[model samples]
Target: MSRFEEELKRDKFVCSECSRCKKIVWPPSNYCNKCLNETTWREISRKGKLVEYSYNKGECFGIVEFESQIRIVGTVKGSERPDVGQIMNLEKCDYDGDEIFIFSSTVQRNGSQNS
Candidate 1:
């Protein structure tokens, strides 16, 4: 198995498709924030498009998400080289022994972005 797949399986992190509307309600919810219907856990591609982003200008801040109806946020990782509208894939990371997803990323060379 690939490293990503191995890590996912080891961590037992289910994607939880949750809803078709594509909104991530942290702490998870029984119903999707947009669709408001029952959701099922599914493995999401560890890749996604960076719709919006900002920098702390050298100051470290807590995780923050974009204003898009569906938001994605997590601990800022690496050198903060990503810019708004960049597409990237998740890298293996851990927070206090808890596996953290998507350490850092940049725009894919192909220019294709995923939601």
Candidate 2:
């Protein structure tokens, strides 16, 4: 398994924090792209918001942003259109013996009012 994928399966959502600038790097890497400095792994929340999305040929993909501004492009699992700021949950998915990450919409607040 790739390092990032392996880490995701073990650690849930993670980001590489640059020791210098403290920039959160998504798609975790060994080195920080911003400062070329060594990065330390930081665990981020599994739930985030869907910022953008697209669907084609029954395939869905979108960008999700976590609490720390950690964003990643992942396959969205549901049919609902992704709206900006829509809450989503990221989780590990097993496919073809490989672990993949996917996002799904979380339950929204029911606005039903008692009459």
TM-score of every candidate: 0.49, 0.71
Residue 33 error for model 2, in Å? 2.3
Q: Global lDDT of each model? A: 0.50, 0.74
Candidate 2 residue pairs that clash: none
Clashes of 2: 0
Ten consecutive residues with minimal summed lDDT in candidate 2? 91-100
Among these predictions, the greatest TM-score belongs to: 2
Predict model 2's lDDT versus the native. 0.74
Look at candidate 1 and give me any clashing residue pairs: 16-41, 16-42
Off by over 4 Å in 1: 1-13, 18-27, 34-36, 57-69, 93-99, 106-115
Report the Cα lDDT for residue 30, model 2. Answer: 77
Model 2 over residues 1-115: C-alpha lDDT tens digits? Answer: 6655666656455667888888877657778888899998777778888888888789899888887467777799876677778778886543345546688877654874322
